[model samples]
Target chain A: METIVLGIGETLVRDDRHWASWANWLGVPAHTLSALVGAAVAQGRDATDALRVLRPGMDVDEAYLARAAAGRGEHLDESDLYPDVRPALAELRAAGIRVVVAGNGTVRAGERLRALDLPADLVVTSDEWGVRKPDPAFFARVVEVSGAKPGATLYVGDHPADDLFPAAAAGLRTAHLRRGPYGHWWAEHPDVVGTADFRVNALPELVGVVGGSPARPGAEPHSARPAFEDGTGAVGGARPARVSYLRGL
Target chain B: METIVLGIGETLVRDDRHWASWANWLGVPAHTLSALVGAAVAQGRDATDALRVLRPGMDVDEAYLARAAAGRGEHLDESDLYPDVRPALAELRAAGIRVVVAGNGTVRAGERLRALDLPADLVVTSDEWGVRKPDPAFFARVVEVSGAKPGATLYVGDHPADDLFPAAAAGLRTAHLRRGPYGHWWAEHPDVVGTADFRVNALPELVGVVGGSPARPGAEPHSARPAFEDGTGAVGGARPARVSYLRGL
Candidate 1:
């Protein structure tokens, strides 16, 4: 793979604190907020849309400002990252693959992600780009920023609707991380289960998806042996498949 | 190209009458509405967003209802079809390319398009899908319905921000149809100017972009000779290029 664009929440970092913080601010029980978030996700809507359901006509931006004033705004740190993030990112970068961490987070969240100094060429959030996921513009921005052609690039995320489907639609290869609630739930989605280019449980598996990296097996590089080359991609008869693991995984 | 997903407005059909109808209903000169629509498009906002600018907080749905109540609801017929649309679509279909016509039109527009019984395999509108273009989901729907992989499908549209860029992001090959104001205006956009896979002045050019059809040159069909192959697509080194007719036309 020429590049791997990772989704921030749930892919690179656990969103427990993030959602809990919103719950705390909204004066709702954490479980209540979490349940609502899950419900929203199950319906293929934005996670924060749960907030709209909980409070009609809620101004999320205003609420964010209110939370900031109350000393509880978007924040991130090394501890928030999944265990596989550091090693996988480092290995991918070592393999010469550009790594970008982008997803539906806030401007402050973007700042926090940058501050964490993740092993990524770029770290950004939806708010920073003034757009959100599932919108073609968000993925367009990701591809634009990565400087990789849509097919040469890969988008790794947990959410099926927000991440995998959109990224796939935007012409980027997709790796569905089978972690997080959305991941597990959407993994069974007909489209994701049947067509995802790479189905990985952890970030480290991506190194394999892109092909054995120099930092690992040192096999022929992915760029040299493109996946989906002859329209016999992972899902044969679909489009181009990468590297041809072609397994359900 | 396994499939060609043609955009509705300004691609297969002109939007003059549609916009004029809205202007008439809104009690504004057609020129005024047209100018405002262009302004919205130039700003990279939805064309209907111009209505919001014309009358603050105007409920477009409500306005449509009002107009419909006055027997001036959404309407379309054979007259709206651009002359190139019929022959281009018919030739593409005869050549075995799945043709899908989809774009940001209303439910009534979808019915009207279906009523036209265009040569396209499917005719759909954004309202029918409950999602609008510039949204990856829309393109994803186009791919899903066409049963073609994103890379194998070509999304032809006139607007850069709405049609070309977003479709490119979603992994479908993009052809910027140089027609109407949005087409010409967005064509000069740095991304569009430098990167659109196929820049065609007419739908007939798309047939060539896909490669010589049997009805024409009788050369190898487009699906038989994929563009963007070997990372030298229309915009070389971007993704898969179809037929290597990379040009700035």
Candidate 2:
């Protein structure tokens, strides 16, 4: 059974409005703050600098940021779940797959997931881990806690650099959830899309990619997997000579 | 034969880097110009205002803007064609589909399409039409020139408001080419996706929706078409009584 670790922001929840809400609460122009965050994401850079650039003169402390985010999280309605999320998670869990919610967000994000009655086996956040994603340590913790083989496990996320690339680098099969800020930013970027093992427009589309019966027709199967790899094609079976030569070496 | 009118900008060509290049030539920050264009796109607003916002104080004349855009267009290399483009167009044309290229770009965009040797029967641009997309007249003209019925003709584009929505409103089947600026931006917005008659990631995917042996296995046949519609499914066959009643009325 493959363990599936899912990233929450923009993957499970539509929390883009929260960015603007947080900016409004902090007295920053909503568009300016959103654009800054977008710019950072587009450049594959951390948003810490972009957030700091929002209030150049003011000394915005960590506590203030946390409280503001929590306040915005509180405003998230049940409708925030992408139309396909709940059903997809339910379907994955029903298939006996362990689904986990791990996101680079505050603890409130975890609380919100629980509040929404999402069917995940576990929920983890950067706030609890004391480290954000794209940091190898965070992915290491996720792999450790999930107890799934790094190569066989799957990490589904919306961000190319933060979620897909790092997860792929950590030896996890990566699914790029092409819906949200990073999804929109990276769709045109072939280099980023190349790093993804699977690319899906909706959550339910993952059911097929994860070795179950695909709910959508014509869903591309593990496209990034090489033709010689198992389950991809018969190219691997024809390489007996190469295998024997390698064994002799 | 189904007439396919395709939008050119990010659909057939990658023109994003040109925005930054033009900005660089104009002595403005690249990020600022790109962000302005992105912001305008996200809001479904015309980029004219965003371009004007780039040079607030300067007396930037129309000739300078045209020259700068032309210079940037000149930098576009053969590599700008998405890997799947040429083959997909060839396949569609071979299948007897009348493929047309129409985009919201300067006249140089049309020349670039010709230079790439895209197998488009007719190429049109907003500059030549004296109108831009999302305007009903532009689509009306495309239908007139192509000699295809509004209901059967397919207009493929990336922008939601500028391409898909207006084409849908104009009674043409709309395929939201899920690449480029709008593909990512609107992927999360369900309301926009609803307007598209077909949503596909690659240009080759369009071959399946346009009526051919689908290149991809399990490809949905015109997934956006309503269940009762003919050519999509047999559900319309089950509605004989309703059809008879409507005919009597």
Candidate 3:
């Protein structure tokens, strides 16, 4: 249970800039796009649905090309990541935890994340794999790249639909991080809170998730237990962890 | 537990060409160099000692440079690999085993192995890490890169002294491969055969080591058992597998 696999968007990088950039290209008020994005998440729809909702019958691919031609073509800089990301990742790797980054990102996004040189062993994306999360095959790929049994691997992400439930169903241990808009809204979802092994807020909290390590900067040691608490087998019954972010946002 | 970390020299590639080239550079009979290598292995000495014995006070680095100057610095092509290697590795990867290549090889050798594009998830050399085999730190690095607990990782190699015994001592599951001069002579070593989790003759036999998989092209299922037979914990006591390589060579 020394491996920790994390989702990319909300778990590692803040998606605020990515969405704001899209809002700028769409010639819509940023708040309008944010509201639509939040509504999409609340209704368990893909975030891209917001874009489709704004411009009905719009070709998403063509819009992507148009946006690129007009200049902002999916850039990822260090500023896009959560403030706690670097230290937590460094601590996890220093403690010999195999930190893997896997989630729904484009190939270019994967390249940018690698360019940042965050202390992860492997970083991959859905676009690179030709599959998206919540797909059982995607979870299988996670287990494959992890090179560890599902029970010995922990999949952490901010999305319940895309990250937690499916990963749990796929036999991997789950952690629900209450970051990003989706995480904030879905933090109270009965299924996610009920199925998660660790319900954490900040990224640095992962240092405490693994054994024999001090909490990294900004880590508040709460809720998460030993990584192997469930033993070396897939999730059988529900092992819940409460979302402690109630009072914050 | 789904990860298999292997030594490169005799487990995957045949060392005949490498040693022959070195003999060519040293201007010695191939058999003489081969016999010296066998003798060095038999006496529990490092294989490099043989080159030292062949030509007293010979600067190995200079010999390497001169060999390179002679247009045969280091060459690793398809023919260097054993015929069973590709099929066995392919089956392991297809079955979702995390195959890692970690061994006492030069950086150039590591690059050559990568160029071959074998089905390994990671290929690294001691030169890359600035540490060599039989060192506990090197074995620790194997578990680190594997991102699995030491109890769940398996270290396989042909050399008993550098590969089997040391890996076993460093809390990893061990397999003794009876392949080259080292493997053939050390197959009978009381300590190695007495400590290995699997003792095998050919690479393809590994398809049977993991769970729920058909044997590869040339595999003959013989002595290995389920990966988690001893359960998830470091090697506390010896769990031996006999060297069934009594017939072939």
Candidate 4:
């Protein structure tokens, strides 16, 4: 049997305006953070500054801040997520996957995930692990926890530096969610295995990368290969066992 | 001197794909078009076979011809555009501010404008049309066309029909590019001003929506009334003409 794949990220509850969660203030459509981020990126700014410019008028959650402080390093907080992501998470977990939350402020992210009432095999916080992604040791934690080899695991995420690069460096196959309106530096990254817009909007899509899934109701499984691969190489092939924790969604 | 806006579209430049143009083909970032189209709207078919899903060995482009031909009736030919676009032709001859081709198909989109090359003010094409924004008309074509009726002229494009409907139908303002991506059916009628997006991409963006030299770059003599009521319920004030046609990267 193949080892299961997992996902990690905050499950903020809200609408597109949820970017304002940190400030506790909502902006109109014309001034939403996504729009600002898009404008700033179009003007050629880096991600950190782009995030700064895109700051919401809201305040950061106390729990989110505490988790970041405990990590003792430069990292974004849990408030980064848009709301309404829990359903996506629950669906993945019910499919019997191992989910390891790895951000510094991930406790807040985890709380939100649990609030959504999803099941997971594991939830790893960088505060407890003392290591974060882009650091192979962080992934090593995944190997240690899940009993899966580095090459056998596939990491799927939206961040390029923190998620994709390190995942690739560690020899694990990687797929990028490419969520939100803006594309990241990893958009051009060669190792990006696949991309999903809104349809295959969750981590299970990568299951197809490791091994194609059986068709679901009203939905056909997609191949894990890159959409543009012109016979250069094939991606992951191990069919990980489904984690039943995510099936309800 | 009111600024001029030129809207352009591709009547035809075959690309053997179910989609209409290269920018759209490129903009989609290589994914399953069928999956992107979503199942709720896909009826109960076991599979959707757009250009994105040809088998690994098949010539993907060739595989889409049958499907594309089936939808060809929904498209308008290049000759059909010249009539409604006449006002823009006159503006170009008068050496107005800029010519904006909002949809994709940039390569062929400019052919119509450049063929005349009648001392154009500027050019904006979807390839370089800045954000390919669904609104602001990529600079409001009808306002540019009528010259004296900025408030009365209706603007139209294919996508985002809802966002544009209120302004046009209420006699406030209007524009319609076409009908598919942004403005699916279930949207209200001629509330749309005119239809474009002839091939798929925002043609105006391809031809020249953002750059080239202004008709008179530095000295923009504002000799016109406000284009609209600013929709802010504010009284009269001189609304500065947007410097959309100036050269940009």
Better of 2 and 4 by TM-score: 2
What is every candidate's alpha-carbon RMSD to the true fold? Answer: 22.5, 24.7, 28.0, 16.7
Poorest 10 consecutive residues of model 4 chain B by lDDT?
B240-249
Compared with the true structure, what per-residue lDDT tens digits does model 1 show for residues B186-210? 4444466444666676787777766
Report the lDDT tens digits of candidate 3 across residue range A138-162: 9999999987788878899977778
What DockQ score does model 1 reach against the true complex? 0.01
Native interface contact recovery, all models: 0.00, 0.04, 0.00, 0.00
For candidate 4, what is the lDDT? 0.36
Q: If you superpose only chain B onto the true chain B, what TM-score does each candidate give? A: 0.84, 0.78, 0.85, 0.34
Tell me the TM-score of each prediction against the true structure: 0.44, 0.46, 0.45, 0.38
Q: What's the TM for model 1?
A: 0.44
Kindly report the root-mean-square deviation of model 2 from the true structure over all alpha carbons.
Answer: 24.7
Question: Tens-digit lDDT track for model 3 on B53-144?
Answer: 65667888888988888897989889888788899989888877899999988899999999999999999999999999878889989989
TM (B chain), model 4? 0.34
Q: What lDDT tens digits, residue by residue, belong to model 4 across residues B1-249?
A: 233333342112221133323214333322122222221122212122222222224454354454356553223344334233545434434444333333443443455545644344444454454433334554443344444454423233433322343223323232333323222221222222121111112323222321232112132212211122224322222322212111111
Model 1 agreement with the true structure over A67-134: per-residue lDDT tens digits: 88888877788878878899999998998899999998878888888888888999989989999997
Please list the residue runs of candidate 2 whose C-alpha ends up more than 4 Å from where it truly belongs after superposition: A1-249, B57-75, B212-249
Error of 2 at A182 (Å): 17
Best by TM-score: 2
Chain A agreement with the truth for model 2, given as TM-score: 0.78
DockQ of each model vs. true complex? 0.01, 0.03, 0.00, 0.03
In terms of lDDT, which candidate is strongest?
3
